[model samples]
Target chain A: MRAVIAEDLALLRDGLARILRAHDIDVAAAVGDPVALAAALEEQQPDIAIVDVRMPPTFTNEGLVAAIEARARRPGMPVLVLSQYVEQLYARELLLSGAEGVGYLLKDRVSEVGMFVDTVRKVAGGGTVLDPDVVTGMLTHHGRNQAMARLTRREREVLGFMAEGRSNAAIAGKMVVTAKAVDKHINSIFMKLDLPLDADDNRRVLAVLRYLQTD
Target chain B: MAREDADRAALRDVNWRMILRLEASISVGIGLLMLIIWALAGARHFWPAWVWFGLAIPLALQVAIRRGLRAPKGHRLLAAHGAITCVLASILLAIWLLAGARHAFWPVWPILGLGVVLVGHAWVRHALPTAREQALADRVEVLTRTRRGALDVQAAELQRIERDLHDGAQARLVSVAMNLGLAEELLSKDPQSLTELLAEARSSTLTALADLRTVMRGIQPPVLADRGLEGAIRALALDLAVPVTVGGEIPGRVPVPVESAAYFTVCECLANVVKHSGALQARVDVGYRGGVLSVAVRDDGVGGASLAAGSGLRGVARRLEVFDGTMTLTSPAGGPTVVTMEVPCELSSPRT
Candidate 1:
């Protein structure tokens, strides 16, 4: 898989490229600045581009602009954006651009190598990935929906884990319970919210996210 | 200046006219007195021929008067000469009148004294010290204001440095210390194996490193130096909870001092809006016109703001002053406080 990387900091860009290359992923080109990356995008076509949310010449939203430009030029290209903080406005902007094959995740997610790689693969394969924290932050503060208001605290925790794309076994380990009990909690949450019982991680995450994200 | 000089010259011409009128009147009176003397004692040798020599006094007075009028701002000398001539001329006229026809020549004595008073009062009242004193006072005031503005700017810069250090580096160091303390406790307990404890120590080290870098960035924002004002401000807005509508654009790179002041002003303004204001939105506009860079931050929040000592407004005012700039705040009691800060790019450095 061919990918382009745009990050303002040299160390972070080099580190991310090394980690991706170690997983046998081809980094077609890596740029430490946004302007050069934009020019490169015009010349070279990459299947996927991983961008940092802030980059130079102005460290503000160069990454967001780069993502928009790439999507505009090649609508089929998959882009994953990394940010230090979970910002609702940025998430809204990304989701509003037709959510297929787009990903927004915290930079710290790279610590979980397996899940991070899986997310990259999913995004490249035409799936949408949203950071569970971003969804949680947005829903917790501003959500006024009745179904969300009725969720028990334990059910909310389960929902959070689900949104993080966690398997039942992992949720069980974190909750210190049997996987059978975790399964029951997940089923109870799905029933209370009246969502389809899809077993796929992406679809399950999307359904829960779409419900919680509703106003 | 030319107009004023012309006005003075016109006044001088008027004074000359007055003196000429006095001399002409006196000349006609003296000629009348001579005719009366000749009529009383026919042109024979009753009076000595040398007595006619006293007539030279009036001619001499006219020469002195004309000379005084020629020089600019020399009214004192000119007026003195005219007054003396008028007094001497008056005494002669009085003696001649008493000796011959005895007309009331003493009336002209009062007119002579009036001229002296007029010249002396004009010099003392409006022409001399008022103009010089005013110029001196103005110079002193301008110097004082410039000095005060310079001092205020420097003091504000120092205050900002203190604030950044206290909030950023100091706070991070405290957290680092706490993290290290916890890691040490875990090491001493050995509840986990040596490997796990080492990992904990490693994690603390990484946390400290990250915190320190954050502190460094907060101090200066290295990206601003590398990129420009636009990039730095956008980065700041991206993290705000409320909507930040950026209006207008800044062209090219500004000098570091200008950029730093503008950057911090925006930062402080945004922080106050988020923390204090119940407003849902903010607007920031930046533009350049006629060599001045203008920055304005407005919020639709409760707007009772004061620059009472120790307020952030005071600090901002001082900061702008350093760049030969000013900060004006228009905040009423209920809503909408607009802070406008303007600074000239190429002004003489403020001197204390």
Candidate 2:
């Protein structure tokens, strides 16, 4: 998959480009700041864009805003947002465009090269991914926390992995349980959270997240 | 400023003196005319004395007004009182002398009344703070409190940062060092054991990095540094568990120290809302107007939050006090708690 990377830090930007190129994923453009990122997006039209939360000029949420604007121009333009810190609010905002083809993770996740590459591929292939920290943050303080509390421990575990855009089989492998059992736990979570059951994984993740945010 | 006012007052005095001289000339001419008329009609009874007293009334009032204006600022009212009292006493003396001082000294009663009122005015002026001194005293009181508060906040911040580093990053680095040493020893013997030890070391270093990041954030958040107070607040609002609607704007960046203090104050308020309020939603409003930067955090929660109730908010208050800032909280027992903090400030250029 072809990709574009936008990060202000030179060290991190080069590292990202090198990683994607090593993974046989073509990195068509790597730039700093939203202005350059915008120009690159227009020219390259990469399969995915990896963005940092803070970028110049006015190094605030410029890159995050750029990613959203890019998606607005072309719906479901797969983008993965990275930040030094994880925030449920930024995650919710990124997912607002379309949970599918979106991922929000901490910048530290780049160190786990295999997992990072897999996330980029999953996002480019139209799957939603959120950091486990964001999910934990959601489960602890959101208005939906009470609903999360009603979930059984095993079912909540399944829900967490599911929100991270893992398939039932991937979740089963992580839990060392059967795939069918993982599916059952997911179903139980949906029912307990009072969400409509869905066949698509991204929609199921979105439904859980829609309720996971503040009511 | 005082010199200019005095010069203007002197010019006014000269004008008044010129008018007084003309009036005095006119009065003496009238009195002399009356004297001549009395002599022509066989002088008797001396009724011109009453006419002179009537003329003195207007002159006395103008003199009293000028005395009030000429007195120093704090003493103006008392000067006016004394001048009016003297005028009344002089009138009483004139009445006594004109009425043939053989009576029971009735002028003493009216003169004594005027003296008593003037003395009372002087006593009150001495006892209470006059306008200028009172304002100075108030300013001194504020400066003293805020200076002490700034020192206290500085000391407390230093202590907290030291403790966090000692327990978090320092401890993790120690573990990582030990793990790396063990990995080095195992490298010559068992590759499997060495690999596990190396992985553990890497994990420990990552944890240490996370710890350092947290401490850095506490000291100065990256977003706050990038965005200034207005945008920093919006970023903070987004992170809270409760849905917070952020409103208002600032024209330019706040100074770094003030920006950090305001950001932490809002952070503490939000943390309280999440922990104590159990409310479904919250609101944060930030605006700068008329040289005052104000931030109000409102939560729809069970209230009863007070500064005396928790050290967290009190610390926030102290932190703000250093900047000559103030916080007011209104949280009645049932719902809708609002905490508003204001700081007098000037907007700095966007970046230094």
Per-model TM values vs. the true structure? 0.53, 0.77
In model 2, residue pairs whose N, Cα or C atoms come closer than 3 Å (at least 3 residues apart or on different chains), thus clashing, are none
Candidate 2 lDDT over B1-352, as tens digits, reads 9999889978987998999999988988888887788788887888877787888778887878787867887688788878888888888888888888888889888888888888888898899987889999998998898889878888889999999999999999999999988888898899998888888887887798899989988998887876687767776776666877888888888878888889999999999999999888899899889999999999999999999996899998888887889999999998789999999888977762
**How does candidate 1 fare on TM-score?**
0.53
Candidate 2 displacement at residue B305 in angstroms: 7.1
| lDDT to native, each model | 0.70, 0.84
Cα deviation in Å at residue B48, candidate 2? 3.5
Query: Where does model 2 exceed 4 Å of error?
Result: A141-153, A187-205, A208-214, B1-36, B39-50, B89-120, B131-139, B174-194, B220-309, B320-352
**Could you give candidate 1's per-residue lDDT for residues B1-352 as a string of tens digits?**
9999999989987997798778767766776677678778877753432343355456556666666556566355546555565656665665565466466556566666767776676667556666668888987876677568658766766686677666765665676566566667766566556556455545554454445545555566755654466666765665566556777766666778778877877887887888777767788888877889898989999887656722766666666666678788787888797889898884333111
The number of the candidate with the highest TM-score is 2
